[model samples]
Target chain A: MIGIKELRAGDSLPEVRLNPVTRLDLIKYAGASGDFNPIHTIDAEAEQAGLPGIIAHGMWTMGNLAKLFTPYLEQGFIREYAIRFRGMVFLGDVVTLKAVLKDLQDQELTFEVAAVNHDGQDVLKGSVVFSAELPDL
Target chain B: MLKDSIGKRSEKVRNTIERGAVRKFAEAIGDPAPIFIDEAAGAESVYKRNIAPPTFPVTFDAGVIPELDLPSKGLIHGEQIYTYVRPLLVGETVYCWMEVKDYYERSGKMGRMGFLVMTKYGENANGELLFTEERIVIISEAVRKGMGA
Candidate 1:
């Protein structure tokens, strides 16, 4: 668990390594997100679209990246999240999520984050800003 | 032309954040945080209610712009950014809409690719901004050719 008080700019959050991506996972995500893009679920459709095989929805990978902050919700909420898809995530690829605290100012803490595949290639890269205190609405 | 659609805004679509949908979204992402699924835990949390995950806004209906004319298949999600005023609470009704920010084409190793940049907004019933999501969708030359546009 992350202790917001003790966190420093150089600290890296505990890494989370997900199991191999599976078809069922994609299907569930597609249904939940209402992103019924066939390229993410049907192998034949992906091949027809010129892809090697069914690929994971970019949002699926992006959603899972938020897990890094799940254990520290009590401290604050994620105020900003930005990410760029650098490479494709295919079925059976294990993605590792990592984040390093980049700066802390007032109630906001920023971290540089990335998701890398089993082969050590970054599939996504970006930064997330966590607000340590919820401001008055 | 795709560039002509730049600055076009879509119609506002209203969405209710339901508990069941939130639960399903949490389950789909494999995040079983009690704050997201268990009522008791939520009651004890700082928010005093179950709050949706930061990425949960993806489920909202961001109204589309007809001018995009994107091919149904082969469109790639290239980038995404979310700026939140606060975490969305379950049971709140949000009005969602989108605007085409920009569009351009570039040549990459794979071939020619078109980048469509759009920003989606979510607001409360009172019309106060809740969050804004900016995304870049990539259209490959192949898909464009397939469309024969």
Candidate 2:
């Protein structure tokens, strides 16, 4: 488990690997999140939307990132985190998530985080801020 | 009759926020960077890995469906903030619990005033708490000529 004290500005978080994008993953996400946007499941819909191919849901990737810190951030230490959409993830694309500690305090922590795809492109860009003394997981 | 309409208009949906889907969203927004498509693209960056686009979770990670009975001119997305432990990647699955966190009704000079806050919680596949997002939207009655349509 990673503790906040172990991180520092310009410090990168551990790397996380993901499984291949599968139809089941998308279907399960649709059912679980209540977002029935056809573009997620149907290739025709995505093509109609002028996309290159079917894509995964944005939140799913974000969830994967959360899973990385599952052991550390079980409590209320994280205060605020937000990201801006910049790129896309094609089906079967293996994505990775990395974060650098931007700031730290006894009560709060901040980091500039990024998500990148296989070809050296940025899929998501944003900053996250969390409380330092958070609840235990 | 109204109850049924309400039920039909407002319904809870299960959503999964994944990485590949975030890439498509980037395409929709006119961004086709490989970082969103291929994992190796992230190798050079300090992050040392591929990551999903921020706010990509808004697509499937579940949120409360609002019932708009009033004839509003336009629904405008004002602002949004997401808090999370780490950045997201392509194949991760997360469950969404969405709801109307708050609402404000006010009377303006021209017509009625209203604002809505939609909140959603994204949980990992293991049912662990991931993060929360608050979406703010504004609604107002449209000004029409003669009798309002």
Candidate 3:
């Protein structure tokens, strides 16, 4: 996935979508991550806390977004990855991650990454700076 | 208030990035990539062993600021950023700690809100930085109303 091919700014990187989030997914994330926040696990607790339902952890969504670039990660190091939580993601929503090449210089490439929920509403928005270009391989 | 927590840092916590946690995290995220769970596949890769996910450092948080008293229930995660020197390799012991970087207030529809920024960093045993995670937690109007002091 290293930038073996010639790439230019403005080209959209491949878009990838993860499996629909499930109650068990959140539960597993909670266990693995030690973030037992009830708002992500217990549905009743979430509603009581004024949420539509159990929402996935923002880190969970950000991690899923990172998955989209896994193929290219080995090519270089992640210099920076940032995301703003823009919308709430409920269980059963499939997250689609899209990234576009924003710039390339000095062996570094900047990309704009976005994650959209099932309804096409943007759930997360951010940018990533990687040490190399994955030549679209 | 959150402002009082400024400049506070967590205790130096050390933990090993184990394979079991990596497997669970990969499975939980529905990532079927073999390198995440298969040692054979990992051995064949550049790292020569399983590597944790990019955001895996979040799990290694030392703890929240002790004095940063904000409403416990109505706090929302605002923005987050993770910058890595490299993907954390499994089986490496990392020293982790965090500190309150910034705290400020702003007006929103709900009313005045407080945003607290904390930066967490993980470094290998040799004292080389592995990754840095910056988190922003916001206390909403509902939080203040709930406190009602």
Candidate 4:
């Protein structure tokens, strides 16, 4: 867990390497998120839609990106999150999550975050603002 | 045209933040955070109860604006932003709705693309605002042609 006092701009958090993307994972995500888009689950549906195969939901990757802040939950909560879908995450592709503290002000820490696929391509990129109580100066 | 939906808003929908669904969502994302799943652990946390993950609101039914009439296929989720007032607690009832903030078109390698910008809102039972989700949905040329727009 990261403490508010220990946080500094430019410090990098521990990298999180997720298991390869799987069809079952997407199915579970579809059920949980209520986004039953077939392109994210059924191969036939994806092919019919002109995609090579099933793809992961953008929200799924965005949700997992929050895992990087799990340890810091005790210190603060995520106040804001924003991301742009840069590329597609295909089946069997492993994703890596990274975040670097970008700013610290008034108990809010801003982090530059990105999810990179196995090919070193960014599938998603964004920023997160975490709010915590800073020690009185 | 899609531009007419710029100020359109949808009917408000009520959603209950269920513990089971929260657990499932947390698990699906591969996050085994005890605060999200384990009740005993949650009781020990600062919030003093289980809390939903930041992205959990995606499960809520933010009512749709009919005029958008977006194509069902090949719609790409271009961007998303969520601003929260606080973490949503388990078992809480929140009302959600959506509004079309803007719309426009741009040409890219994929040909003409329509960018639909909308905001989804979640409020407490008392009608106090809690969070707002801003998203951009991209309708590609292929999807537009399919819709014959």
What's the C-alpha lDDT at position A73 in model 1? 82
Local accuracy of candidate 4 as per-residue lDDT tens digits, A24-109: 99999999999999999999999998889999999999999999998877777888999999999999999999999999898788
Q: What tens digits encode model 2's per-residue C-alpha lDDT throughout A28-48?
A: 767654566777788988897
TM-score of each: 0.96, 0.53, 0.91, 0.96
lDDT of 1 by residue, A50-111 (tens): 89999998888988998898888878889999999999999999999999999999889999
- Assign candidate 3 its CAPRI class: medium
Evaluated at residue B124, the lDDT of candidate 4 is: 93
Candidate 2 chain A has its poorest 10 consecutive residues by lDDT at: A68-77
Predicted structure with the largest lDDT when compared to the true one:
4
Evaluating just chain A, the predictions reach TM-scores of: 0.96, 0.88, 0.90, 0.94
In order, candidate lDDTs are 0.89, 0.60, 0.81, 0.90
Question: Candidate 2, B54: how far from true, in Å?
Answer: 14
Better of 1 and 3 by TM-score: 1
- Which is the better candidate, 2 or 4, if ranked by lDDT? 4
DockQ of each: 0.80, 0.12, 0.54, 0.60
Q: Going through the candidates in order, what is chain B's TM-score?
A: 0.93, 0.65, 0.90, 0.94
Please report how far candidate 1 places residue A113 from its true position, in Å. Answer: 0.9
Ranking the candidates on DockQ from highest down gives 1, 4, 3, 2
Can you tell me which runs of candidate 4 are displaced by over 4 Å? A134-137
In candidate 2, stretches whose alpha carbon ends up further than 4 angstroms from where it belongs are A74-76, A135-137, B1-80, B83-132, B136-149
For lDDT, candidate 1 versus 4, the one ahead is: 4
